[model samples]
Target: MKKIIEIKDFTKSFGSQTAVDNLSFDVYEGDIFAFLGSNGSGKTTTIRCLLDIYTPDSGTLHLFGRPYEFSMSKDIGYLPEERGIYTRSRVIDLFVYFGNLRGISTKDALDNAHQYLERVGLIEHKDKQVSQLSSGMQQKVQVGLALQHHPRLLLLDEPFKGLDPLNRQLFIEMFKELKEQGVTIVYSTHVIDEAQRLTDRLVIINDGKRKAYGTTEEVRKTHGSEHIHLEFTGKFPKRSELYTSVSTTKTAEIIPNKGVDPEEILQELLASDLRIISFRIDLPSLNEVFIALSKDE
Candidate 1:
């Protein structure tokens, strides 16, 4: 696949403080590349520099195989973490204004906005003022505005923030639809669970530095996390042999301190006359990996 975005040694500093330190990664065309970081971990700063909102003190960023520019930005859609809308503007008017700014004609913008509103199940609120809409409704509207111009690349910063469970599900469904249509998405979020569900690849950052960058499977493998949940009859096997930590009960979870093939571990447990009721090699959840990485940091 062609490269959609690339950042090389991208660094940014504010006076004595550094926000992004030598961060580098590539986003492939048609991939949902997730930017995972905690608060103040430089996720936003990195995105700002990538979007040309902040000029980096050092390093380079290229989009679509060339240097980024204002004209290139026209082909991009951004939904920032900080949501904003004209509080008094009518819903239809707000979408039209934003879409028109992105080169859609006023009439077409309104028509498309109405379509999006209907799709998002907010068509009944079209004539309402922005302030009249609930927080979730407003968020969906902001997303509609960003998408109104039908850009190929979307930069979403915490798109699920402030959304209820139902609304969050709606956004997830929408993202899946967009991804199926080959839209390149750069999703930034502190919510690792959501990222894990949507992303094909993930870049994790901490303390203004890259902690991990690769496919989700690669990262988990590099971290050496064996997500094997084991069930044994009688007493649990000698904890030291299987792993340093093995939770005992109906299902014993063996998390080794070193690399041990889960199959081998299971075989050993069974060979030792340990009645194996059930065993499974569960992949490590992103949230679990995040916690482990954060603790290591």
Candidate 2:
């Protein structure tokens, strides 16, 4: 895949507090890249730097293999973490205005707006004032406007925030369809479940640094410990020469040393007197791995 966005040693500061420090990552073409972090972990700030909404104190950013340029704005659609729209304007009218900025005619913008509204299941609310719509509805409007011009790259900061399950699903479906059409998508969020399901690659920031970065599996393998979950018939092993950090219960968790294979360990258990009923490899979930690394940071 081609590199869509690249940030090299990106650092940003506000007053005296560092928001992002020496962060480096790459977003590939036609990928749904997840910009993941917990609250105040610099997800938004990194995105702002990518969009040139905020300038970095140090480091380099490249979008589409080039430095920041206003002309490129039309090719990149951005939906900020704080989703907002012109409260006084009709939803459809707002789309028209934003589309015009991207050089679309009013007639074309209206057509595009309604088409997007239909996909997002908000066509009935198109003529309503932005202030009158619910927060979720307003979010749909913001997304509609962002996509009005069908930009090649979509940068959505916390796109699923403040959304009900149904509405979130709607955006997920829309994004999947867009991805199928080969549009590169980058969305930032603190919600791990959504990111796990939606993303092809992920970069997780913690305390202004990259805690994890790569394909989900790569990141997991890097920072997430591989473990064996064993359910035994009797005499749970609390201490083993092969495994440490043995957590006991009806089902016990045995965290082996790095590079230890579960299959090799299984042979040892079979040689013992302890009756083993079942065993499975337990790879840490993205949420668990991220929280663990974030806490360490």
Candidate 3:
């Protein structure tokens, strides 16, 4: 696949503090990529630099195999973490206006927005003013607008924030559909579980540094230990080495030692006093990896 986004030694700073430091990564075309980090980890700063809203102190960025230019923005769509809406305008108008900025006509924008509203279950709220809508509703509107011109590259920052469970699932389904159509998406989010489940590849940065990068499984495997979580029917064993930690009577995390397979631990448990009720390998979530790497940093 062609590379859709590239950042090499991308550095950005404000006054005495560096926001991003020596970051390098690639997002391939048609990939559902994730940029993940905590609040002060340069997720938004790096996004702004890509959007031309902030000039970086150093480094380079490329979109669609070329150096980023303001004129090239029409090919990209952005839904920022901080939602922006003209409070006085109707929800439909805002979406149409956003579409207009991306070179879509009023009639097409409205038609498209209507379809999106229908999908988001917010069709009735189209005529309502932005001020009348809740932040979550406004967020839904922003998502509709981002799809106005059917951008080739969608850049979303905290896209699932402020959404209820149903709406969150709706958005996830929406993005999954977009990916199937071959749209390249790079989304920034701190939430780990959802990212772990959906992303094709991800980069986890902490304190403005690249802590981990690659496919979700690859990054997690590289940074943190995988746990064989066991729930037994009796007392746990007094074990060492590969037997890492226990949370309760029936549950524990067993880290495989060097060349020891997780199956070996299960084999040991099978012959122990406890009767096994569950034997499952729990791969470390991205959040787990983040905490481990951040502590080291």
Candidate 4:
């Protein structure tokens, strides 16, 4: 697969504080890539450097296999973490203006704007002033603007912020459609469930350093473990050398000790007075892997 974006030993600093530390990663063409990290962990800082909003202290940031240039802006769509729009302008007007700036004709821009608005459930509010719409509505408008020009690459920073579950799912479907059409998307977010569902590959950062990076399955297999989930009635079993468990009310998650068989643990539990309702063993979810990787040392 072709490389769409590359960062090599990239580092950045603000005063004496380091924001990103020798980070390196590649985004392949047509990939839905997740730039994941908790707040203040330098996800935004890496993106800013990639777009030249901030200069790197060392190393290279490349787009389309080369350094980014102004001419490339037309082929790249960016939705920054800090969002702002013309509050006094009508919703449709803002799209038209930005679309024109991206070299689209007024007629095409207007048609595209209307199409996007309808898809995002905002066509009814097309003529409303930006200030009149809710924050999520404004976010939808910004999303439309970023996509109006049909760019080859999309960079979205915390794009799901403030969106209700339904609206979030709506946009997730749209992104899937875009990916099917061959758009390469790199979005930074801390929302683990969405990332696990939408991303082809991911990188986790903590304290400005890369902690994990690979295809979703690879990361999970490399850093995650399997555990048993149990639902039962009555008193839970006492702590034993066979396994460690965490439980609440009627459920427990058990991690068997090394060299211990899950069957042995289950037998022990069965011998206890508790009535087991259900039991299943599964690999750790991306959320669990994320928490374990990002935890403070």
Candidate 5:
């Protein structure tokens, strides 16, 4: 696979505070890569440096195997964390303007704008001023503008912000379609489940440092523990020295202590006269891995 973006030993600082600490990662062509981290954990900082919006203190940021240049702007689509659009401009006009700036002809730009607006369910509001639309609606327009030129690489920062679940799902589907069409996407987000579902590979960062990076299953195995999920009846077992358990109404998630067998825990529960409904041992989820890594000292 060809590398679409590369960052090697990239570091950035503002004043005395370091925003990104010697981070390095590669995004492959046609892969949906995710930058998973909480706010202020360097996800946005790394992206800005990648786009050359800010100069890095050290190391290299490359696009298409070379340093980014103004000429490459037409090949990359970026939706920044900060949302800014011409409030007084009509929605369709904003898209057409950006399309033209990307070097598309007026007729082609208008055609693309109409197609995008319809796809995003905003065609009915094509002539409405941006200010007349709600924040979520405005965000849709911004997304359309980023995509109107049909760039090969798409970079989105906090793309899910201000979106409702339905709209989020819509965008997710749109991304999947783009990926199928050979568009590579790199998005930074704090939403763990969405990242797990959408990305082929991801890097989890905390305090501006990489904590875990791999396929979701690989990260779960590397940074997560094995646990038993139980749906049961009767009084639940009390916390035992052999394991730790978190439970609600009729379900419990039990994590055995190191070297303690899950079978041993199951036998003990059965001996206690608890009617087990169902039980299965599984690796922790990406969310669990993220929480555990974030708490690391």
Candidate 6:
């Protein structure tokens, strides 16, 4: 895939506190890249540098093959972690206002506002004041505003925050639709489950550093972890020697040490006196990997 955004040795600091330190990564075109990190892990700061909201103390950021600056802002849509609106403003009115700020004409902005309201299933509430909508509805409105201008790239910071399951599903469906239309997206979140489902590639950040990056499978492999789930019918058998390569033999489930064949281990179990009724081998979820890495810190 073509590269759309590149951060080369980017570093930023506020006083003596370093928010981002020598971060480097590439966002490929047409990718739903998940930016995973805990609070204060430099997610927002890196995004600010990418958007030129803050001039980095060092390094460079390229957006769409050019140096990043506020000039490129119109080509990108951003949904900040904090959701805000003029409470007294009508839903459609707010959309129109924000769209116009994004360079859409008033007439066309209002038309697209209504269209996006309907698209997000908020058409019935278009005439209502922003304060009249529930918190969830307000969040959806922010998303609608972000999409109003048909931006080439979308930067969503904690988009799923404060959403119920149904609304979260709605956002996921909308992201899938956006991906289908070839929109490159950078989604930042601390929620691992949502990231795992919505993203094909991910960059895991911690302490202002890149902890892991790549396709989900590739990241898992590089961390020397696998999803190996095993359930024995009877009492769990004693630890096996061959399983130690990737596993902590103390537990039934194994973490591969050197990509050992789990089937070979199973075969040895069957040959031994251990009785087994059930077994399963599944990939470790992102949450598991995240926890493992965090513990290593």
Poorly placed runs, candidate 5 (over 4 Å): none
Better of 1 and 2 by TM-score: 1
TM-score of each: 0.90, 0.86, 0.92, 0.91, 0.94, 0.89
lDDT of 4 by residue, 1-297 (tens): 999999999999999999899999999999999999999999999988888888899989999989887778778889888878899999989988987787778898899888888877899999999999998798788888899788999999998987778768878998999999999999999999989989999999988999899999888888876788999999998666888888998999998888888899889889989899999997777898999997743
Q: All models: lDDT?
A: 0.83, 0.85, 0.85, 0.89, 0.89, 0.81
Would you give me the overall lDDT of model 5? 0.89
Write the residue-wise lDDT of candidate 1 on 125-200 in tens digits.
Answer: 9999989999888888888888876678999888878788987888888788888988899988989987877899
Q: Report the lDDT tens digits of candidate 3 across residue range 1-297.
A: 799998999999999999999999999999999999989999999989977789988888888887778666677888889977798999888887787777778898888888888877789998999899887787777777777667899999999887888779878998899999999899999888889889999999999999899998898888877788777778888667756665587677777777778887888888888898888897877777878887887
Count of clashes in candidate 4: 0
- How far off is residue 86 in model 5, in Å? 0.9
Better of 1 and 5 by lDDT: 5
Task: Give me the candidate number with maximum TM-score.
Answer: 5
Q: How many backbone overlaps does candidate 2 show?
A: 0
lDDT of 5 by residue, 6-31 (tens): 88888899999999898888889999
Residue pairs whose backbone atoms clash in candidate 5: none
Mark the regions of model 2 whose C-alpha exceeds 4 Å error after superposition. 229-253, 257-261, 264-278
Clashing pairs in 4: none
Reference-based TM-score, model 3: 0.92
What lDDT is obtained when candidate 2 is compared to the true structure? Answer: 0.85
